[model samples]
Target: MLFIQHLIRLLAQKRNLTLLTLGVLAIILFFGLRPKTWPNINHAEWSPDTQGLMFHAPGFAYVDDLHTLHDRASDQSFSICLAVSSAKQLPGFRPILMFHNGSDESQLTIAQWETSIIVMNGNDYSYRLKLPRISSGDILLDGKPRYLGITTGDVGTQLFDNGTLIAEKKGLRLDIPTNEKKLRLILGNSPYGNHSWEGTLHYLAIYDKQLAPEEMAASCQLNDGIDRKNPLLLFTFLEGKGTEVQDQSGNDQPLLLPSRPMALKQTFLAPPWPNFTLSKTLLADIIINFLGFIPLGAALYARLRLSEAFSRWYPARATMIISFWISLSIEMAQGWLPNRSSTLLDLVLNTLGAILGVLVIKMSWNTMENMLSHANSATDLAK
Candidate 1:
C-alpha cells in the first residue's frame, strides 16, 4: 500500500533510521531499569503440615486464670520488653500485648496502627509514636525481627526500638489494679481478641520495676543475660515444640500458645495498590509520562517528514500509532514488576503527550518554511 511505501522510504534515510533506533532503545531502557513498586511475596500460601503458634485475626494466646500475672502487676511503675516480627504487610490495628482485667473498663495495650506504634493505658488514654524516616514499603513489608521495649516510671513513659528511644510522654502513670477480677496477660492479641497480631513473638518479659536506660538497651540485645535484673515474668519461646511457653523468670507463669498450627517459615503478603486519586504522586507521574514520550513523538515526526510518498496528515497519524504501541508495551512490562501497576491512565497520558510533541514540531516547521519564503521575496525586491 501507499503507507508501506512511505514507511520504507522513511527508513531508507540514514538519519531517520538512526533516530528510530535510538528511540526504541530509550523506551526499552526506561522501562527495564525502573525500580519495583510492590513488595515480593516469599510464600504464596501456608503449608498444610506447618506447626507453630499462628494468629490470624481474632486468634491470640493468654495466660490461663490459674497462671495469671495479677500478682506481678505494679501500680506505680513497670516495663515490658519483647522481640517480634510480622508475617504479612497488612494495614490494621494489630495488638502486640494486652493485659485485661476481664472487663472493658481498664487495660494496658501496645499495638501497631499502620506504620506507627501505639500504647494505651486504658480506654481513656493513648499515645501514638511514628517511626523515623520510614516508607510504607519498609514499614509494611519488612519482616526482620525488631526489639521493642516500653517502660513507665515517675517521670514518664518511654518506648524503645532496637535500643533507640523512639517516643516518650511525661506526667502519665498506669493505674492498673494488682488484684483485679480475672486479670490475665495476653500476647500477640488484643484484650478483646479482635485486633489479633499476625506475627512471630520470639521473647517477652514483664517487670514490676521500671528498667534503667542501660538495662533496657541490654535487654534488646537478645542475650541470655537480658534478665539480669530479674523480671517478674518471662517467656523465651525456647521450648520450640511445646504448647506452652515456659516462664524462664522462675515465677512459673507459662503462656498457652494458640491451638492453631502455623508455619515457622518466613511469609510475606503484598499490600493492595493505592487508590486512584488526584494527588502530588499522580501529578508527578503525569509529568514524567508526558516528558518521556516527547522524544519518541519528535523522532516519528522527523522520520515521517523525510518521506514525500506520505500525505500531509500521515505524520500525525503515524506518530500517534507509534506512541500508543510503545506506551502499551511499557505498561505491559510493569505488570510483572513487584511494585508496579499497569494502568490505562498512564497509556492515555503517554499518547496525548506524544501527540502534543508532534503538533509542536509540525508548527515549528511550517513557521520556518514561511520565514524562509519571506526572506527570498525580500531579497528579490532589493535586487
Candidate 2:
C-alpha cells in the first residue's frame, strides 16, 4: 500500500495535459501499425495477357506497353486492329468489312474506310455492332463504297446510318472481288470492345461470293473471347483492305495496356468530394501526400484521429504519397468496375501536386500563426 502511494505521487508530478497527449499518441500508434494495404493501379505488365492490343492516336501510332504515351509504329492503318482471332479460317483472301461511328473521338473513323475484299448483298444481312449510346462509345459510319448495303441502330435497329437504305429489302448484294484486297476492321469510341464495339463483323469469307453456310460458321469464331454474334459486336470494315496489321508471322494482336493496373468502379452514396478528381470523376480526396511520411500523416490526422473506423477517410500525407495512393486506388477501382486503368503518370502528378500544397502551407504557417496571435492580443486590449 505504501509503495503504491509513492508511485501514484510520482506519476501525478507529470502534467495532466502531458498524460492526455500521451494517451492520444498511443491510440494513434496502435492503429497506424495496422496493415492498411490498398490497391495499386500502376501495377506491372499482365502475365497471362488480356489478348488485346492497345493503340493511341493524334500520331496514329500504337501506345507503348505503359499505355500512357504513344509508341513508334510501323503500320499507318487508320482502322487499327487491337485483337484478332487465331481460329483458323480457310487461308485465302478473306473478305473483311470495316465499321466506324460518328462519335469516334479517337479519330479512328473513316469516310471511305475500305477494308473488305468483297461486299455482301442483302438487307437482312445488315451488320450490327452492339453499343450503348448511353455509354462512352457510339457507332459512327457514313459514306459509301462498292457493292454493299449498310445501316445503323442504337438500342434497336432504327436505321441511323443508311448505307443499306440505298437499296431495297434484299439487303444489297456485293460483287465478291476475285482478288483479296487487304481489309481492316475499324473501332472508334470503343477501346478494344468494352463500352462500345467498333462494329459488327458479320461477313468474313474465304471468297467474295456468299459463304457456303458451313464456311461462314467456321470463320465466325471469336478468337479473342468476344461474341461477334452480339448486335454490338459491329465488325465495321471497308470494301477493300485499307491496311493490314503486320504480324510478319501474321499472329493476333497482343494485349496493349497489359501493364496498366486495373481499378474498381463504385458509386458512393453521398457523391464524391467536390474539389478532387479521380480519372474523370470527382471525389473526396485525402490530400495527406505532400510529405514522404504518409503513415505519419495517417497517424497524425486520420488513422488514430478517425471519427469513423471503417470509413476510408485517411489522413493527408506528402504530396507524392497522396497522389500515388489516390491515383492507384481510384484506378484499381476502375478495373474491378468496368473500363478503367490506374495510370502511373497520374500517380506522379498527384504526388507532385500534394508536395506543392505542403510547401505552400509550410511557408505560410509562421505568418498565419503570428496574425492569429496579434488578433488575440488586440481583443484582449479592447476588453
Candidate 3:
C-alpha cells in the first residue's frame, strides 16, 4: 500500500510527463476512433509518382482502360485483338479501340444491369450519332426520347464469354462501307443522352489463331488485365498484400518484383506535409484546418466538460451561445495563421462541435457531479 501510494505521488508530481502522455492518447483516440469519413486531416502522405487513370466497377473482377478508345470521324483506322466470351456481361465495353461520336463525352459507362452505356454529352445538339458494330436482333434503341432503329456493322458470328473466339470467317465485315455510312448509332433527347447497346462481339484477333479459353478467363480475372500471361501483375515482395505463402515458417517464395515508378519529389513548406506546401492561400488554409479539427476539438470538450462549467458560470441557456462564439473566434483567428481556409464548411463543423460538447456535458452531469460530491464528503469526514 505504501509503495503504491508513492508511485501515485510520483506520477502526479511529473506534470510534463503526464501532459505529454495525455496529449498523445488524445491524438490517438481522435484519429483511431474516427468514423470512416475521408479526406481526413492526415498531415503526411506520400504522393503517387504519376496519377493513374483507370476504372473500377463495383463487383467486376477486371478493370477497363480508357486509353484503348479508338476515335476516327472519317480519319483514323484502328485495330484491337479481343476474345469474346459469355462470362463477361452485356453493355460491356471492349477495350476502347476506334472511337466515334465521343468528342463531347466525359466517359462511357457500361451498364450491364440495364444493357446500356450512359453518354454524358454536353447539352448543345438535339441529336448525335454513335457508330459501333451491328449485331443480330431487331434492336430497340431507347432513351430520353426512346427511339428504335436497325443498325449494322461487318461482324463475325460465334463467340462465348469465358471461351475464346476459336475461329472466324476470313475477312469479316467490321467497318461501314462509304455508300451505307448511315450504319450509325444515334442518340437524341425527348429520349436522348442515355441509351442501350445490347449485342455481342463475335471475335477479336491479332493473327489467325484464337487465344485459348483459359487465357481469356485469366485475362478477365485481373484488376488491370496487365500483361496477363508471361510476367503476371503482382505487388512488390516488400508489400504484404497479394503475396503467396510458401511454408509454415512464412518466408517469401522467390518471385522477382517489378521496379516502381520514380518518386514524386516535392518541397514541403511544413516538413513531412506535401499537401500543405501546395497553396499559399492563408484564408483557404485556415478554413481547411478549422474543419479538420472540429471532431477532435469536440472530443476534447466532452472529456473536459467545458460546457457544464460555462452553464454554471452563467445561465443554462447560454451554454450553446457561449460555446459557438468561442469556437467561431478560433476559426476566424486562423486567417492570420498560415495554411488555413475561410470556408463556410469549417464554421459549420466548429459550431457542430460545440453543440456536441454541450450535449456530452448535459448527458454526464448527474453522475460525474455525484461522484465528485461524494469524494468531497468522504475527505471532510476523514479530516
Each prediction's Cα RMSD? 13.9, 17.3, 18.2
Candidate closest to the true structure, highest lDDT: 1
Between candidates 1 and 2, name the one with more favorable TM-score.
1
CA displacement after TM-score superposition, residue 353 of candidate 3 (Å): 7.5
- Candidate 1 residues lying further than 4 Å off, grouped into runs, are 1-54, 66-74, 124-141, 175-177, 258-383
Cα lDDT tens digits, model 2, 15-39, are: 5424543564455334323222233
Prediction 1 TM-score vs. true: 0.49
lDDT by residue (tens digit), candidate 3, 1-383: 34444433443344543454357446633532332223322111111321111111111111111111222222222122322112223332222112123222322111222233222222222222332222222112331111111111233322223333323433332331121221111211011111212222222221112234454444333134345332211212122322121111122222211121111111112122222222344455445444544444334443343333444434324544554564455544433322232334455655565565455545555555566567668889999
- Top candidate when judged by TM-score against the true structure: 1
Per-residue lDDT value at 16 in model 1: 65
> lDDT of model 1 at residue 135?
12
lDDT of each: 0.62, 0.28, 0.30
The stretch of ten residues in a row with the least summed lDDT in candidate 1 is 262-271
Clashes of each: 3, 68, 30
TM-scores for all candidates: the values are 0.49, 0.28, 0.26
